[model samples]
Target chain A: MDKEYQIQGTRMKFWMPKEVDHHKAAALRDQLDRLIEMHQIRELILDFSETEFMDSSGIGVIIGRTKTIGFYGGKVEAVNLSAQVKKICCASGLHRLINIREVAENDG
Target chain B: MTDKKTNHMHLYFDARSVNEGFARMVVSAFLTEMNPTLEELSDVKTAVSEAVTNAIVHGYSTEAQQVELICDRNEDELTVTVSDRGVGIADIPAAMQPFYTTKPEQERTGMGFAFMEAFMDEVRVESVPGEGTRVTMKKCIGRENGR
Candidate 1:
């Protein structure tokens, strides 16, 4: 809850926790969904540098938000996925739904 | 209660959504002595999360129930059992089938068991309708696999 989620113009960036389970997914979705709707955000960037574990619940969070913003032709991008997290995302077929990219430390 | 031949831990926590992450962390930390690879660790953690989430969400439906996590590990393998005393599953095979969920309204992917099966060496589900459900999973973590 103390983690900061940033929004700039049409782009929004949020940092995930070390573990993205059902508990964390719900709160993250609620807050981000509200921001997406309020700001009419077209792009969402999920930063996963701090995340080491994620389940289908985490996948649900991404898909839920992707659908919310998709109404406005907005897309979701996930970055800094650890190899393990990337494998889970790919197994869940999240890569097909969202843009998966690697983010350098210097680049926000 | 732990046996001398195998190291084990038993956890009982309120079936609150907040404890899902905690359950996974406990299991992951227990497996750390085996020095599992990141991928293996992730696989186990994700599977545990799914099992715990199912217990809290679909099983109890947020009714403030109790969930149990029992972990046992020897030098060769690790086993985890997640149980809940909530509304039990009537048909487990159908439940395990991909894309099938009791709570489709919540947009559940219904891939919880699938991931558990894929990641662990073996997965077993035991449920008695109106009684509860138990999911037991085991994975090899011997020298060849863990190291």
Candidate 2:
């Protein structure tokens, strides 16, 4: 399964499917770290286009990455949020922490 | 978020839906409208998942249980409730604190409540130890025009 991540330029993008609770959280974290290291990522834009949900562990992944990205003077952005998923991001204060732009944000 | 507000259909779910993200999206899609922003849907979905996950893992540790979801929509409010009859939390304040987790090895972020608090207009978590837990969240949809 190519659930790892894809890197290009300074943008380290990954797919976060919901159900990212404890069991898979560790794996997700490791995967993110490796990608950041591989491309020496300075900026990240996660595509949740395929993801349906997330949990505390998933939140941890983002927060931890925010810290990591901050150290490198990078930023994290999220695009393509379903209404329901957007609620969770707002509830988690992800909007404040990360740059949340819908697919249209990448447009004009 | 800058356009207008609209009401969403009331929703429900089971424990299985929360642990599995796709199951949750089934409900998320149910609420999407022509103008429904992705951020709006994501926030609600996350809060629902967090609540339901709490029901399954914390509320029903090993035994069979059910998670009940009810969504209510009015002119300006969208409320979601996730309830389960599992082991209840002994301390609410501590659990609400950032980074406080009952299971650390499980990689618990302990930010579930934090997220809910940030996303919803009102977030209340009530638990009766050995009984169950219920999370009620309310948000004002399409607050663009104060609708």
Task: Identify the candidate with maximal DockQ.
Answer: 1
What is residue B3's positional error in candidate 1, in angstroms? 12
Residues A1-108 of candidate 2: C-alpha lDDT, one tens digit per residue: 755466668876677764566446678788888889878998887777877656666767887888899898999888887665566566667789988887724433
Give per-model TM-scores.
Answer: 0.90, 0.63
- Model 2 vs truth, CA RMSD: 6.9
Model 2's CAPRI class is acceptable
DockQ for all models? 0.67, 0.35
lDDT of 1 by residue, B53-122 (tens): 9999877765568999999987658999999998899999999997788776676888899889988899
Q: What pairs collide in candidate 1? A: none
DockQ, 0 to 1 scale, candidate 2:
0.35
TM-score of chain A of 2: 0.84
Q: Estimate, for each residue in A1-108, the C-alpha lDDT of model 1 and write its tens digit.
A: 666677779888878888777778767778887888798889888999899778888888888888888988888999999987898888888899999999833363
Where in model 2 is the C-alpha error above 4 Å? A1-55, A62-108, B1-14, B17-23, B33-35
The count of residue-pair clashes in candidate 2 stands at: 27
